[model samples]
Target chain A: MGTELVGGRTVLGTLRSDPPLTLRQTGHGTVHLVSTAAGPLGGDRLELAVDVAPHTTLEIASVASTLVLPGNGESLTVVEARVGAGATLRYAPEPTVLAAGCAHRMVVRLVLEEGASVSWREEIVFGRYGERPGTCHSRFDATIGGVPLLRQEFVVGDPAVDGSPAVYGDARCVGSVLLAGPAFGHPGPGNGGRPGNPRGHASVIAEGCAVLPLAGPGTLVSALAPDAATLRARLTWGLGRS
Target chain B: MDAALLLLADSRLPAGGHGHSGGAEEAVRTGAITGPEDLARFLRGRLTTAGLVAAALAAAACELATAPGAAADQAGTRPDEPAAGAAPESAWRELDAEADARTASPAQRNAARTQGRLLLRSARRIWPSPALDTLAGAVPDGAHHPIALGAVSAAAGCSPHDAALAAAYTSITGPATAAVRLLGLDPVVVHRVLAGLVPDLTSVARTAGARAAWERLPAHAAPALDLLAEQHLRTEVRLFVS
Candidate 1:
């Protein structure tokens, strides 16, 4: 379905973190987020909209795994984000877990002027499905400075499709993120195949990392830190300082 | 089999496709794909899903380009009775928009569009179809592969039938050559393998049904390849994305 914010001011920047949330925003505010609590949610939506005037910092967060339920009624919880120019939007949400048979659709849109910076990440687990063993379709679009910088679409699942060698060769876990603005000036990895380069992908940042392969896993976590240098360097390399 | 199709579809055409492995080299590194058969399977899957999808979209564009007097025919149209001419120019507006929506990764999309532009740069000269000229004029940046290929086919005096043939051959030839590079297969052996595919590709090209004519053209699908790409994005150094 659609997300309805529970509480907030006039600006459409309000946040409610319950099973179903609503966030409204009126005038100047850093952010208005509706975060979900612990435990599994029955496929609820945390809808958020940020109005970052001239110069503003709005950081949004999710309480936990926003447990996305297997889809029977086409279960979904979506976030509709819109960003204005000269605004810094740092949206780092907890990874969404698609419990067995669950399906989800997420749409994020950011409209930035010449100098707005946005670091957004989308990660998913196939759930009890053992490395996400089914079909999933996702579409993402972004327009920065009148240029449509990113647009992604994919469908996972089905024999006719799965049987093909083209789409998915074998990896299970997947993640995608986009970086915009001046700080990303020297796009590091340029094309993402160079040696020792890692810029565009924010997930590699040391703030939270588990370098160990996932064949067998162990818990690894760390609070976010202001020391974004290593991250920045990696980003530069990943983006290929071009 | 026509030798021209082999040249037309070769990824090493300096079309910037060398920058992309269609996720082959990338996926293989991630262990998402392995060995010769795996490569074949992956390539086949891409052709049917992502490849097929791209072809369908391109076919529509060709149909549009072929419209009679398509000043009238611009680009991105269906190969309807271009005898009418007006249909293609208008249809392309929507078709190209749809392609923009379907393609996500900005980098990958850029790769595709860039390839299309270069292909058009060369194809327009090699085959100069009015459809190609008009569509290229209407879309200065060059349309996506399907659109460009469609226009190219139209200009070359081939029907939608020819478009399909060209697409299939282009898709297969690239991988076959790559296989030759990766496995060091003899050119004679590669040619034999390629020869075996001709009948099937030609059949598909010539086989047209009413349903095929009216459908929304299939879309590109290659998640394993994409995820492998994501995996590659994380690599410290790599030979290909997958």
Candidate 2:
């Protein structure tokens, strides 16, 4: 739903959303999504759609943390986006805190054209205060020219499942960074003018998608971390910000 | 059940599986897994997430190989003519990309490709099918492990479901075997943990076989696994490749 501009900058097009979701343009190709309903309530179904034209860039961020309260039914959020050739989208949403008795699922699906690029980040905290976390499932799928580029799914805080070392390894906060496009090449720590940050480990899984993980000090520390602020700061640092 | 599937699932098939621990070595080094209980939990989580993803990819690949016109395309004579369902080369590349997306560590990606290449080498001799040859020609460095497994499974006259079963079983077996060697856990106890997982493995394979399209394949991922794979690569002394 977007087209190329003269300078090859990506501008948002056909931005559509409903209640509890507000949009404010912070800068060119940048918009901040603000929630007005405190947070997603029980049985809430939310959808956000974005279209980035060719030669345009879109940066999206949430105004605050998405706090999931106790709900009678499961809450869901679905995001669908299309990036044209030479377009880019940087999606860095705030941390999501799953409260007790909450069930939430978020699905993000993106379709990219040749030469398109996308950088996305998601942070999840088990609980806000001292309460146990609820069930949460997050899925991400991206395709280029109808071909799959990346696909990932995460399930957290389910009572039926044991705290497997392979899944979370006692980490309460989990953060992920995904960069895909012609612009994002495979760059390790030593190269790319970026010193290696030991706070997180990044790997270029493919030509496009790269993953970074941020956790706490020891096994106990990582598991008992009260919040995601430390992890977020590390993530911001990992993404090359001062 | 196809007898060839047993060969593909065997750890002693000279597929380079023995050299890789599937990140279990790193997990042990970090003290994330110290006993049979922890190992069981780890395997269960891995079986549902990474194992499911691999099973789905293998199933889809097998379906692609056995599709109509696959035999004709295997001749490698028709670079212009598209296959009956999806173009074989593009489809294989797309599947490979999905595999890359699902894997978030450079070490794991390299390990997968290495294993894939080794598997293809053995398959070309044992099965000697045109589909496998064409796939081998397409990705000289090697397709991802699941992609190669599917193609080889089809060549060996196995169904997509059988391929899925093989893929699912191998995902945990590699790491379990590695734990036995690294942690010196009792082999019987280590295998009992695996034996307890038969029902889940069957469920995962069934789910994988249900999906026919590559685009709709499972993307379940454990971020801890990605982290472990990267950490395993940096260790000064390590027993396994990943």
Candidate 3:
């Protein structure tokens, strides 16, 4: 994380990781998050922090899909990020696959200063190869000047999700994209001008909302699909404009 | 079991709740809920996810309203400027924003606001309170339904748990009633389904009441419901507002 910036680059930044949790700087303002272990096993805990200073940008990605295996315990991931004024942070991680009998909890908190911009996506697959989905509890809380831009928590694999038409329905894949600040005037594909009529059934959640403008500050775009490929395509479409 | 809770939860309380089906109308139209069994599952799903979220929010609001100095917090209040001369409860706005963030569908958000407005109108007459006036001033377009319900519950002397129960009970009862109207399902059978869910409903209320922190309140998102609301909004022959 950067405490200051110089010459349009991060002046102070640091990265720390434990086993199976490594950070690799792939390019200028870009980092590839890699895990050495086969994947997240039971009882694993991971923490990450990134700080983008003014006039700098940071992009985060994962090397491959993170596999969540069955375990007697649960795993947790907590990420804290700060996007400074005039800075940008884009986080697009690979999909996470929840295998049967696994329980995982993820919490992400982002603080954005004035003029900061962020474009992030999170994709989840219930299970791979037709297996039943495991349990997952994810919470995202973000703010600007202490005013809430987004506060959301989702639980999967509960009895409520088994056959709820109000939830997943028949889709096994779900994802969300968040675009905030003045930088995203309408980033991706689609006619960002016409109030966005999101359609197309086969791939996206037939009933999922495409793009939604928030009350005070941000925009949230969410989608549901039958598989990762469809979700990825839709996310890419959203990312293009953002 | 409080009388105030019952009154506030009553569908006939002139809240304009009858106009929206809570997504049941669209679900029925799409054949997602073709019979009583399907309707039962739908209600169960909604009760646990969205229902739980609403319950927690109502409970949180009730706590805020019943706190010490809540009344004097309301000073010079007029019809158009309600929040004026009032205690600065930034938490109220944050909770409202949380509701906005949890609601992913534009149609759903509009529906919730409409119902909230109607509830506020009815509450202001039924139970006169400066807190309600302050809320009205704060959110002229209308606060979200759960927020209004919580505030009204407090004005009516209901506990946070009572507010949670009221919120959770209405979350499903409204839709169950909608299903009966839309599909001509036997009211006897629908009531039976609701009866079977009594235990779960009570559990949900208790769980929601136990959570004191607004940020810790549930933020479950139902993609299917979000999609259905969006689809319902676009449908020309829709009978429900959402």
Candidate 4:
């Protein structure tokens, strides 16, 4: 059976995986699900719970992007992504592309409990103009403590505008490059994926256009790419330097 | 009012609106906006996210009448809290505060207020609404464009919602004028683009009123067009102010 557990508040849940990770579905390829029983808040603050046992390595797809939607009710969507001191969570979904007309809000708090390693990505499509249908307006915020950790809000579908003046010139696609880590501590331009650089990097690639890696020192700051080659150079420089 | 729509596009008018391409220049040069479809996309995006700056300001102006102390804030000072008389006025004061807080850009705050002041002066001379007369006397210098537009709209034989329509339309035409100056697209084509885009603005204004009527709040995603605008400000060559 493919199942797992979870937790809340930075994750109040104990996390488990389905199919043991290595055992894939052969045909459909591999799908990894990390379940947790983190306490969720609702009537009485949803206390999230999280539990991740050591020695468990989860295989994840190097997704193109990942997008978080908005809150369901009056409450915000809180997701606690935690990696145990020894446990690793590789979350490389196929760049969870956000469709136009999607206005969501979410809170993603990750707890890398010492020695824990996880690869996470978040991306959004500004649409390829008429080829696409709409835009997305969502907010993503996270914090390790009362201090800020990762706070991002990408609100698409602003009924106010259809396109951005930068890429399209009264055009439609706009990708906000926001990614950060210890590597990009200073407010300098970031390179593309190199490796070992700061492991914290987020990027977005629209169509065949250049893929921009929002690689920086902070989790919320992104270094944008003007073209695909630039994006490649950025990733190469970033990972290479690392 | 359509002439108001036209004047909004006429950067030549001394409204200082010329300084701002309404984000058109930045979006195009930066690659966020391009071409016709891209232009449409850019328009929609601007209207929804960045456009809120104007919409909310317009809405606040429309609601100024009910605010008891609205006159004080309007008197060249930031729109202030309603007077301390009634409970409802106090609620509007809180609403005005939220609107100010949500408008995070200092420059935009200036632009809105600047446009408002001039608009109020012109509108007050042409037509008179008790709301405008009272608020004008209470507020200082050029009131923000929204407050001016909303109040002025009432004075000019229009509704708050109609003011919103005009306010929203202003954002688009400003850029089209830039496109004409920048690209020299045919006169007919420019009008064609306007014709197609106009309905969207009208619809957005109505929807905005409906949404504002409810939560009395609409989405707040003022895309940091200021970044591009800031860059433009530093550039040696630029056609618009913003």
Best by DockQ: 3
What are the per-residue Cα lDDT tens digits for candidate 2 across B19-119? Answer: 88888998899898999998998998888888999999898788778883553343233456655653356556655666776765556667888899999
- Model 3 complex DockQ against the native: 0.41
Interface RMSD of each: 10.4, 7.9, 5.5, 10.1
Q: Could you tell me which 10 consecutive residues in candidate 3 chain A have the lowest summed lDDT?
A: A194-203
Give the number of the best model, judged by lDDT: 3
Cα lDDT of model 3 by residue, B52-152, tens digit: 99998888778767762332232211234343343334445556766876775667777888888899898899899887888777777678899889989
TM-score of chain A for candidate 3?
0.85
Error of 1 at B182 (Å): 3.1
Ranking by lDDT: 3, 2, 1, 4
lDDT score, candidate 1, position A180: 56
* Local distance difference test, candidate 1: 0.49
- Residue B69's lDDT in candidate 3: 33
Residue A43 of model 2: what lDDT? 91
What is the per-residue lDDT of model 4 for residues A1-242, given as tens digits with 9 covering 90 to 100?
Answer: 12133331122123333321222232222343322222111211222223344434444443133332222322233445554555545444332333333333444555544445445544344433243423443444322212223333455454443334432233233333333333333333222121212433322222222222222223222223333334344433433333
Q: What is the TM-score of chain B alone in each candidate?
A: 0.73, 0.92, 0.91, 0.72
Using alpha carbons, what is the TM-score of model 1?
0.60
Docking category of candidate 2:
acceptable
Candidate DockQ scores, in order: 0.26, 0.35, 0.41, 0.09
**What TM-scores do the predictions have?**
0.60, 0.85, 0.89, 0.52
Per-residue lDDT value at B171 in model 4: 72
Task: Please give the interface root mean square deviation for model 3, in Å.
Answer: 5.5
